[model samples]
Target: MIDAHIHLEQYDSEVSEQMLRELPSLGIEALIAVSMNLDSCIRTQKLATTYPRVVRSAYGFHPEQPLPQETELSNLLEWIEGQPREDFIAVGEIGLPYYSRAEALERGEAFDMEPYIQLLDQLLELAARLDKPVVLHAVYEDALIACDLLVKHNIQRAHFHWFKGPEEAIARMIKNGYYISFTPDILYETEIQELARRYPPELVMAETDGPWPFEGSFAGKITHPSMIRDVAAAWGALHDYNPGQAEEILTANTKRFYSL
Candidate 1:
């Protein structure tokens, strides 16, 4: 099994190394380590280089970070432009945070879609030019809006990890052939389970959203790539497939969606 999305940068170097070493024993063959900041992009890319076959990377600014300054954005664009085409599997973990804390939102300390939209628009253009898929972080109507933008740009390959949105929005995403990834929450989240059931198996994949623990079995625990098997188990239960069969289908769907 593969953990389609993980935050390898969230752990310390020693911890990260230990986790990666243990992932295979837990049935995880690979991971898409996503970046949440400019520095994290570099760090994640380095990890990918170190592990090559075991760790793939997706680079982007996460929504929790403040909007980039002009020079910073330009520098990031330059770095992205010069990156070896195959080094990154996608452009991701990017989008707005609609439910951020009041103070942070007011202080503009958090990423604001209003300002970052232009940056994301540029990213979409870049993704289109590079022929890479995008991993999105927006949820609810925000996810719908991101989908609208992707469609408007004719960017066909997009993945929404840990998705939570209205039925209409989800249907639109399905209609557009966008893929939605599930997380360990499937073990206890009835809403997510229903969502898994609503979407066809082919359009769904499982992820751990690692370093961010889920409730129930993993409450208060740091998430790991290994937990993806738990998510797959829940998906299998929801979709009426045996565990092995569900893992296979979801794994195939993940590889197909990301062009891995």
Candidate 2:
């Protein structure tokens, strides 16, 4: 099975090495290791270089953190542009900062939405130019704006990872034939399970977002790619598919979406 999205570079060196070494026997075929920033991209690139058969990299800034400075942004974009096409599978872990903005607002910290939107605009434009798929972080009302930008760029291949939104936004994504990945959260979150029920199965994929942690059955456990098998089980139960069938379906969908 392929992990559609994860931050493999975030884990400890020893843990990551052990995980990568044991992955094949655990039934994990590959991982789409996404970047959190330029440094993160470098680490992911190195990991991919070492595990050529098991890791595909995606280079882009994650929006939950502080926005990048002008030089930083330019450097990241230029670096991505300079890389060979096969170095990365997509431009991602990028989008509007909904959760971060909301947290700031609650803290009574004045927030600027325009700059984040502009940054996403720049990133999406880059993705379009590169002719690669996008892994979006947009959710809630932010997803609506993201949908608009995606259409503006005429980007046909996009993945909304760990997505949750209102009916309108979900419908918009579906209309565009965009894909969405379910994390291990689907095992315990009714909201996530309902999302699985609402979305077209063919457009669905399974992921663990590993090393980020989870709760319930996954509580206190270091997230791992193999956790996606449990995600497949839960999701398959919703669609009346057995465990093996679910894994096959999710693996196929991920391979097709990422052109693996």
Candidate 3:
């Protein structure tokens, strides 16, 4: 199994190292460590350098930050362009947030998304120029808008991780051949389960979105790559497949999507 999205930087170095060491035993073959800030991007790249086979990375500024001024945005773009592309797998963990609180927004706290929409457009241009896929993090109407940008840029390779869109947007995504990943949330999120049911198995994959476990079953718990098994199990139950078969299909889907 693969944990398609994780933040190794969120954990301390020693603890993150220990976790990586345990992943093989836990059935995680590879993990895509997503960066949420510039500093984390550097750290994520370093981690991937040290554990090349176990970890890969993605680079992008998260939407949580307020939109940078023009000068700052240009500096960020230059910095991203200067990074070693081979050290990363894609450009992602980028998109808008629909329900940010006022305080969060004031603190540059909540996800405003306007800046991210601009960022997405630039990232898509970058992806097209570099010929790489992107991992998107938006839900509902936001996801639809992101897909629209992808279409506009003709950037066909994209992964909409932990999707939470309405049926109409989901239909549009499927029509566009955009892939979606299901996290362990499937155990509790009927919406996620319905998404699993609506999409073809070949286009569907599983992720743990590690460091964040599902509620009820594992409240206040830290999730890991190994828990993808549980996600696969839930998906199997929803799709009426044997556990092994479901894992095989999802594993294949993930591999093909990430080109792992």
Tens-digit per-residue lDDT, 1-260, candidate 2? 99999999999999999999999899999999999999999999999999996999999999999999999999999999999998889998899888888999999999998999999999999999999999999999999999999999999899999999999999999999999999999988999999999999999998888888999999999999999999999999999999999999999999999998
Q: What ranges in model 3 sit over 4 Å off?
A: 101-113
Winner by lDDT? 2
lDDT by residue for model 1 (1-260), tens: 88889898888888889998998778888898899867888999899999997899898888756678888877777787789988898988787766663456688775445776676788787788888899988788887778878987898888999999998899899899888899988888889988988987888888988788678989888787878888888899887888899889989998898777
Task: Name the regions of candidate 2 deviating beyond 4 angstroms.
Answer: none
Candidate 3 residue-wise lDDT, 1-260, digit = tens: 88878877888677788889998788789988887767778888889999997888887766655666787667766777887777677887776655453456778754545666887788788877877788888788888888889888888888888888888888888888888888888888877788889897888888767666579686887776777888888899888998898888888987898788
Return the TM-score for each candidate structure.
0.94, 0.99, 0.91
Local distance difference test scores for all models: 0.84, 0.94, 0.80
Better candidate by lDDT, 2 or 3: 2
> Against the hidden true structure, what lDDT does model 1 obtain?
0.84
Worst 10 residues of 2 by lDDT: 204-213
